[model samples]
Target: LVHILSHSGLLLLRAGVQGLSYAYLTALVFLHISREGKRVSLPRALLTPVPSVPSPRRYMCSLSLFHYSEYLVTAINNPRSLSLDSFLLNHSFEYNLAALSSWVEFTLEKLLFPELKQITWLSTVGLLMVVFGDCLRKAAMLTAGSNFNHIVQNEKSDTHTLVTSGVYGWFRHPSYVGWFYWSIGTQVLLCNPICMVGYALVSWRFFRERVEEEEITLIHFFGEEYLEYKRKVPSGLPFIKGVKVEL
Candidate 1:
């Protein structure tokens, strides 16, 4: 009996340690992504002259493929950004810490108690969900380029053009949806109640804010044309009947 108790205690300790490690790793991922938005000021001597305005078609076609490629690389390397808050609570440091703690406790309890092993399936599902969600997100990001900003605080680029092809044709906010799913997937894989709740709150907040912000910008830039597109395409959910609007 004493040996069994000691083994149980050790298992619990290991679970707690694993939980804390996961939380810290996740936090670091978010921070790494967020820091990329800081703009480095170039010397005035390095500034290039702006060219005269060309026709819209000519301008669109003339955009350097190299510039787009660079943006894609930057986005992939630093994907999290300020949007981490959207996946976490508003003032979530304590909550995240709590989640880590709870996860550890739960993991420990499961190790000692045979009944807790049943929940392992849930974590497995979550792992699969996260993997699938990540693939979708990467695809969307590759298609969206600079139009996709993971940082909520950054100003939307003024140079954004109306992109109606690829994933954009199916859903207005595919990337955001991908992000939402990704968070859900993480919580599922971790199988922590605290993380699940935190994930839900953060995902909802970010999705709402991102949709509203993008819509406002689209309206401002595209005006009637955007309205028409919004009418036909669903906002977040894919393949649903969209609201009809006359441009």
Candidate 2:
């Protein structure tokens, strides 16, 4: 009877956390829409307060905040790049899939083995990673203001120049480095071990390819200037050397 009671309590707790998560997301959406001078059709139920708890749902809110900040920073730094894509919430189906997978994994693990749900220190670390990574990425964007674009430029525009100051001086690809760590941090925040590992591996692979591809264009655009910058700074990602060029 005690065991059953404990499980029921856990279930209820999870429900409350999930409810709060939904409410938070709804509120954010309404806030965004209202800011844009659009009518907000928020449900009445969303206005009802829900008790919050330490859960994966909290991290999910963090993720939404991340996307919102990404949009806000772009709007400030590179207004020309501002568009629907600036939000980055629905940039790709895979992004949604990843978030879904993390939540599913966390839910299953929590339900089946409640003891595994809380790794306090690890979650704290994950939160730190999210905060720092987001800051770093935003800093890169600001430093590269006008030079930063959501998409890699194949053709160098007059405004485009090799950015090697600030975060760029620290990491050849500071924005990518920040984003790569930030992706893994989300899974870690959820305490989904499988998802954490999966996120790390996939993020590493994606950034590795992207860094190399972007560097090729960098070389084409700035020639010796870019090559010199590449030589001075590290790729900023673990085990990623980026493109090789003989000086």
Candidate 3:
């Protein structure tokens, strides 16, 4: 940032910083909500807190297990699940890349074309994309409820049935759909055209591989029901029909 300031006069870095800030805020919101450990109407829950029946206990019990416990859950389920670790890691990678990409693009564009300037409309559109994309991805997670665990299991528990409602009604992988847009939005919000393209390509490739692997497991678990679901609903992109099944 100091180097960018020395070259590009500081305002150029703001967009990059802002994009990173949004990612941070989104992560914090998700983490806090997820840790609260209940699947309820988040807005209502936050706004209307229930009075405690018992006195507030002064306790921090580390021994008590939580669903979001990464290590323990990983132990319980399949560690090989790409949905568990890889997707989250990819989420971080996408944001980090946007932060760097935006900074680099701004500095270079400013230095290379000192007279020319980035268009205002691009920034406006980028901002909208970021906001909308974030909402879409987060909505998918919340809507899916218990069916939306971090892991992709070969053998699902009795309680863990397939989700085909909510956003899942229109798309097979709405979270992935949300993420695809969000990843691209991060790059665009930073006004990094090259990185935006790069993000799209990389993310699409990963989603392709991930969907193939995940759907095979899904088919095994859900049987013909999953096949019917796949036949009816598009996987990622809405217009994309006839998605090839690997297994």
lDDT per residue as tens, model 2, 1-247: 4643353344435657653543455366445323134443332212212222354544645676677667667767776566545667556898778878888898899999877777766776776787678789989988999898888889989888888889988999999989988888877767789998999988899888999999999999999898878878999999999998765
- lDDT of each model, Cα atoms only? 0.50, 0.73, 0.53
**TM-scores of all models?**
0.52, 0.78, 0.58
Q: Ranking under TM-score, best-scoring first?
A: 2, 3, 1
What ordering of candidates by lDDT runs from best to worst? 2, 3, 1
Question: Candidate 1's residue-wise lDDT over 1-247, tens digit each?
Answer: 4643353344435657653543443333323222135432221111212122111111111111212322334335433332222222333575456446645655675577635434656755654565456556666767766555544433445656677778878787776676567666665554556666776776676567657765776676778888878877777643323333343
In candidate 2, stretches whose alpha carbon ends up further than 4 angstroms from where it belongs are: 1-26, 29-53
Sliding window of 10 residues with minimal summed lDDT for model 3: 54-63
Candidate 3 lDDT over residue span 1-247, tens digit each: 3542232223224547653543343343344333245543323323332221100110001001111233223323333331223224334666556556655775686688743234445544554555455556556666665566665667778876788888889788887787677657655544566777887877777778777778888888888998999988888653444336655
lDDT score of residue 133 within candidate 1: 62
Q: Which stretches of candidate 3 lie over 4 Å from their true place?
A: 1-99, 114-117, 238-247
Error of 2 at 35 (Å): 24
Model 2 alpha-carbon miss at residue 91, Å: 2.2
